[model samples]
Target: MTTTATDLRAQAERHLRALVGRDDATLYDDQWAAIAALVEDKRRALVVQRTGWGKSAVYFVATALLREQGAGPTVILSPLLALMRNQIEAAERAGIHAVTINSTNSEQWAEVHAHIRAGEVDVLLVSPERLNNPGFRDEVLPRLTESAGLLVIDEAHCISDWGHDFRPDYRRIRQMLAELPGGIPVLATTATANARVTGDVAEQLAVHGGEGGSEARKLAPQPTVARPAPQPQEDVLVLRGPLDRESLSLAVLELSRPEERLAWLADHLGELAGSGIIYTLTVAASQDIAGYLRERGHEVAAYSGQTETTERLALEQDLLAGRLKALVATSALGMGFDATLGFVVNVGAPASPVAYYQQVGRAGRGLPDGARASVILLPAREDRDIWAYFASLAFPAEQHVRTALKVLSDSDRPMSTATLETYVDLSRNRLEMMLKVLDVDGAVRRVQGGWTATGQDWVYEQERYDRVAAARRDEQAAMLEYIATSECRMRFLREALDDPEAQDCGRCDNCGGFTVAASVSDAAVQRAGDRLTRPGVALAPRKLWPTALANLGLDLKGKIAGAEEGRVVARLTDLGLGQALRDLFRPGTPDQEVPVPLVQGVVAALADWRPRPDGLVAFESRTHPLLVDSLAHGLSRHLGVPVLGRVAIRDDSVAPGQGATNSAQRVAAVSRRAVLQTEPVAGRRILLVDDLVASGWSMTLAAHWLRAEGAEAVLPLALASET
Candidate 1:
């Protein structure tokens, strides 16, 4: 049975119908074009279509067709574990053998590898991060790249810095494509790239010969990887479809308060047609909202990056089977969960309109004609604060990056991130991001023990960084505009992405197609307010000092004993009273006496606190001495407890910010200065008071010293935590 190109295309169409479980299924012309380019012509292509446009079908069908031609396995660089899992399940319906190598399925890697080597795998999915792993990069990648039938980048926009959700790990893809042998089909796909990101990605694809020979735009500083000369730009076949999702009805609800928004969700979640997602800006909000909804009798659960991998799989299944009403989630649950979601509600606006479109695109994916899913936005005032917090963690200053590189180059051996933090002022997240960027740029490498310098020439590229920062600010402003605009919401989103065919969707609130009430019951608002305003969050005791501190010449290592459990009056991100605490502790704000309301709140918190304290002790703060002293004296006076002497610091000792950003360095810095002033009180119960707690190391070290002085218990009380 010799199959011609037309026969193969017809067979692929049949497979698509069988995969979707509808005999009447038909492939869109663009989908057919993309599949043929990959399987028949063996040319490179980029497919930019909206979500649920059968982008997966193009790849799955192409993989099957290519396999029939006796080609090697199809390699897919999927971004998230959830996306990989969904793709693998979808592949199964088409009777294709798909296996994944990821952090979650490490135990089965040997089996997967065996399957690949045995020609038993039709498709192999790996995270882009896997490309940098020493073992995989040196061993598995060479084999896969050399023999791969096709290379598919699921969310291709991540390869470009101009993309809203750019990742450094994706930069490795350019190098991977350059090394790939010619005559191999390559495909890149995304649903959320704007014109700028699209051009950036297209340039890279052209440079890699995905396009026959388009001039490659130098997007970033050149990497050290060896690259071939640019081919002709005619090689790339781009299939861009309309960005609008016709099955969605979009609207915006302006709620003045967090409590009121929560009340509205609790009241209207049941009214939404079918199961959907409720998106939040943070993990704390997701958990809080999920808990509140459950108490109000909605079958909901929280999903975030922090959720255990196994539990996340189960939660996704629950949502898919319609066993749960909604999964309150953060951006971690954003990409590629192929469920026929009926609605989506945003509790807070994302800083980028492109990001918002990608998230809300999850709804109505599988809806039939005449059926529409609801997409609503409930914008909050606190969103800007959250945005600022995240923006502050962006790329480090040039000096910090240089310092890290110099330290790594001079080190005799690999240095762990904790050890590296001892030399850099950047936080753990920022430092790690810098290192990854350097790793891709050929300035550093990650070995078995830790990170090491590669001694390659590096440039700061200030211009590129500035451009990215400016782009981010513009995106934030656009998000604000999206919330305020009286025009079509969907149209605003599409236009933000610079979609060429964008027009009035005629289905958004501003278009008068649908309306969602902004009202909440007074009783529900009162209850939600009570929940939000409720004070006191338990602070878990520090179990162990950070590992490898001894390696940095600090004696502090191993478990931190005698550090009693702690509590805070409230988190800085809490819904109720959070804004007041934020303003009170804001940077550059003058040191002042504790507010009366906070004093009263602390009094309320202590009433519920277990085991009344015998005495109150204060810690001297280099940052806010007056605040600490006032708070200690007020709590002592209100509780009728004795005032113990202060734990003073030596003038010669370093401040908290002067030391490493790691726990061990902070503890070492604090330990050199913290000294008890009063005589030891044997067998006494002590309450340690501080104005604010950032890392909790100082409090832990203080408790260690107090326990050494014969204190029975140490209870840490702070006004607020920077959660």
Candidate 2:
């Protein structure tokens, strides 16, 4: 029953044929070399290759060879569910049994675990977050480490802080590596790592079997693995190849306005080569773009992190089956797929060239020779502001980190994130990321109760954080430069990624003598303008008071009954009137009467509002009394409704300051200042007017008091809503 080299090669070829459904399927030199290192030499390897460079083939072929030699299952640390599903499908085609453990598959974990224990699974896939799970880490990881034939880290750039999409959970892979038995043969693969990230990842991979030596010392929050002094450089093979994509034709289309950009997409989308992706910067943008495209009679769906898991699965299937033209998506649709994507259109500039390369790399992958795919970047002026907003959420200041740790240290019991927010000034997303980093660095522990401090002496690396911040700033500058550059676009990107073989791509817009049309039809532009300018975002009434307000000494606990629903003429972040509203509400600017255009829009909205108001009441604004009074009087004059008095602030000490504090704090601030000043509304429908609605607490409190005073109904209206 012994298997010879010839037999192994034959079996690999068979699997390759099955995977592609072609007899000519074969592996390139680097792919075969990676497979040999894993299956024959049993050494750890890092393959930093471009998309469609057969990185997956290396691991799959190696897995098939190892399984024939009676090695245990291969465990891959995949980043996204989309990736896991794609891997599973590919594995099945190769006749390999594969299963996944992720948030979406919780119902089947018990069965999957049973199958793994029973030795019926050949490959198992898991997300990085799963490594820190209380149950999986304590129960299953130990067994998997001992039995896994080969460990794979897909999208391995995520392990490096320098990576565009760094994940703290991916760092836990080092601990897993330390526990893995010698000669297990690990493989880490990525398509977007530059020289710096490549080096960082290579050192982490070498942490196994004492091979890291001093190179491992180069990493931060150093691996938790206790190693006997640095040994010789391990057989860590780093196979970095050229990242040039011959089948990709790159172009940048600069539009003057957001609406114009949408119009151009409406005009050019159908003309693109095949089914592809339309990448947007935010969830709102994705939804907005999808709605517009659908109205234009194109079949598209919005795919984002906000998308439900089942819906995401369905969308993925539809995209793969070509039932839909494209998915207007945020970065939530992580750049991972095996589809023969023919085009990719980025609606806004990504913050960095590295990220841009990764996104556009999704297209033209695995295309037939001489077949090209289009990659377009529709640059917008708003992209820089969006980039700055995202950059603001990077790792917190040392003082902030220390504040969180000190609070955890002083707590008697485990505290949930919601409770911790009452103490920390950071946003929920930033705090959770910090906690995860701290947990992995041995500064804290997450248990069933909640999170508890571990009291580990964690040193805040100020220099490292500063360097990362500087790199990010440089990347942003580079992106802006890319937009203005006349040099070859692909060459600039490849050089930015430190691709040694970088060269001018003759197929790009610059070298190829082509330019994306800057003109959009007048009709298309008008339709886009109409959609953008159309206002009135529904302001859902607050159903329940924020939880645990009692701990903050507030009497409020349950849902606020009889909460009046409301609407704003526009969001301060809206596409059309946002800038105008933002300018009007800018701090330190003198208050003026309501602008004519905004008044017109508001009047238009009120004309269509359900149940016309019988009276108007102004909410006193300590900062903008003139603006508030003017708006109320204008509404009264325009609609011929009687002007009832204002909701007077009880005292000077109660105005909620301009900055966004938490919901509970805002509500608490409002309760003391918002006093019902006028006579009881008494069975008459009333309109509550305000200059701006930040947290909606002021309106909520006002409505509650008016309803209590026997008002028939309260309809809240605002000039602008700050999200």
TM-score of each: 0.95, 0.91
The number of the candidate with the highest lDDT is: 1
What lDDT does model 1 reach?
A: 0.84
376, model 2: CA deviation in Å?
Answer: 1.2
The lowest-lDDT stretch of 10 consecutive residues in candidate 2 is 223-232
Clashes in model 2: which pairs? none
Report the C-alpha displacement of residue 504, candidate 1, in angstroms.
1.1
lDDT (Cα, tens digit) per residue for candidate 1, span 1-723: 877868877988888986777788888999999998898888889889999888999999899888988999999999998898899999999888899998888899999999999999999999988876878887998899889999999899898887888888898777677657888899999999876676677667765534322222122335422122223246688888889999999999998998999999999999998899999998878988898899899999999999999999999999999999999999888888889899999999999999999999989987878899999999988899999988887778899999999999999999988888877766777788899888877788888788998787889878777777888899999999999999998889889887889899888999999889888999889988877777787877888877666656777667777557778888887766676788888888998898877777787788888648888778888788888989999888887888877778875557645554566667667767677775565688889888777788778888888888888898999999877
Deviating ranges (above 4 Å) for candidate 2? 1-10, 209-234, 582-593, 616-629, 642-661, 664-678, 682-686, 691-714
- Residues 1-723, candidate 2: write the lDDT tens digits: 876766767777777777667899887778877887899889989998888788888888789889988999999999988888988999898889999999888999999999999999999999999987878877888789789999999999898888888887887787676557887999999999888787777777777636542233233336332222223245688888998988888999888887898899898889887889999887767887899889999999999999999999999899888898999998877657778888999998999999999888889876788999999999876677678778888878898789889989999999887777666666667778888888777787788767898787888877777777888899999999988898998889888888999988898898874456777999999998777767676777887876667766777768786447787888776656665786788677888888887887787667666648889889888788787888899889888888887888886775456213456656666776677788658898888888888778788878888888888888899989876
